[model samples]
Target: MHLADILALRPVPAAALLMAITRRCPLTCAHCSTSSLLSSEEHPAEWFSGFVETIEPEDRPELIMLTGGEPMLRPRLVSSIASAARSLGTRTMVLTGGFFAPRVPPALDDVAHVSVSLDVFHQREVPRENVFRLVHVLAERGVAVSFHVVGSGPDDPYLTEVIETIRREFRDGVPILVGRVRAAGRARAWATADERVSSDRPRPCTMAAWPTVSADGTIAACCNQDVLDHRPIPGHLRLGHVSSDSWRSIRTRCRTSPLLRAIRTGGPQWASGRSDGGYCGTCRLLGTEQEAPASPAIAYLEQQVIHAQLSAGPAGFMRRYGEARFADLVMLGR
Candidate 1:
């Protein structure tokens, strides 16, 4: 699948699954989101394989996104999971820090897309030259590829220079997803706090549309790093464990939960009528009050909201979730 195809499904519930297959990474980037290390905890390959085996062709997601401290670290496991998902008509995507450069892993040969993480922090560990070489190799091999770049903000000089460099190197033949550095994982110590949402306005969370499988095999309603890292996930955001929950069960809860619907359509501020602790903090505090079954009118309104977002298309979604300045770059190579 291409980058535009993936972003176009951002607002649809359960359109895809984000699986963090491992937490062990070779490099120690300062902004590592999962706080991955050489010795980070990783469950047996069976845990991931068994869960993927449950994906039926009729009930599978459109895509399966594999991530980790470094997903490429476990090439065999990545290939197995991708093969299983592909067998059920689900395409696979892998996001990595690109520790193995100038040598694409054989396991990724069948992956639909590969996104490499590139930033000033990552350059200290993996040279820019190596990352470029790897991307060229993948593109030459007929695999769709892109870059996931993080910067201080839209005006960061490094962000500008790097985008220019990539466009020059690839002649705008590759796409990029640019985002602001978030205060999660190791970056929490230094990354700036996210801009607070105005309590007076609604800010629907698009991230909640897809289910994310944490490194430990617990699935969450959204990809919030904090929620995934904490033990005993907040009652509202917790989906279920991969070890015990089937894809059908997780997708059903994600799609049918009234509270999750509220979060996606109207945001936590709308659900509670008052922001308790920022946007996501108040989300964690929402309870049965927001779990009322959706009336016919409410359900219709929810559908309208989803359709509206979908109509805006991928670039529009990027403008809302990613850096607005470079949002159009997501569709560059499409």
Candidate 2:
């Protein structure tokens, strides 16, 4: 699958799954999201394999995205999961830091797509030339590839230079997903916080649609770095542990949860009606608050909202959650 195809499915509930296969990475970029290192914690391959085995063909996610400090660190496990997911009609994608650039691992042979993280910070560790070489190899091998670039903001000169470079180098054959660096993970200490949602309007969270599996085996409702890293995940956001929970169980909770539905359709501020804090802060508080039962009217309205977003398509999603200037790049080489 291509980047456009993946982003188009972003607003659909339970359409995809994200697995953080390992926390160990060779690179030590200053703005690392997971605060990963060569000695970071990592779970056994069996835990991940067992979870994939439970994905029944009839009720499985459309895609399974493998990520990590660097998922390529465990090539065999990546291949195994991709093979398993493909058997059930589910495609797989892997996002890596490209530490092993210029050398495509056999593990990624079965993956539908591969996303490489490239930015000023990442370049400090993995040379830009090496990443370009790797991307060329993957594309030559027929593996759909893209770059996940982050910058200080829309006007960052680094973003401008790198984007132009990628376009020139690939001749627009490769696409990119551009985003602003958020105040999360290692960047939390220095990066500026993202803009907060207005209390006056609903700002739905598109990221909540995909269930994320953390390194510790806990499955969270969303991919918030804090939610994944912190202990005692809020009850409302905690789906279940992969060690015990089945795919059916997780999907049911993701699709049926009233809080999640409210957040997805109306955003955390809209759902909670308290704008004293940030967007995710309000979301974290949702578990403690008492939520009324969803009425038929509310359900109908939410469905309408979902349909509208679905019709708006991937570019719309990128306009909201990604760097708007580069949103159309997602459809490049489609």
Among all candidates shown, the one with the greatest lDDT: 2
Compared with the true structure, all predictions reach lDDT values of 0.89, 0.90
* TM-scores for the candidates: 0.97, 0.97
lDDT of 1 by residue, 207-268 (tens): 88999999999999989888899988877899998899899999999988888888888888
lDDT of 2 at 59: 93
What is candidate 2's TM-score against the reference?
0.97
Model 1 CA lDDT for position 285: 71
Report the C-alpha displacement of residue 300, candidate 1, in angstroms.
Answer: 1.7
Clashing pairs in 1: none
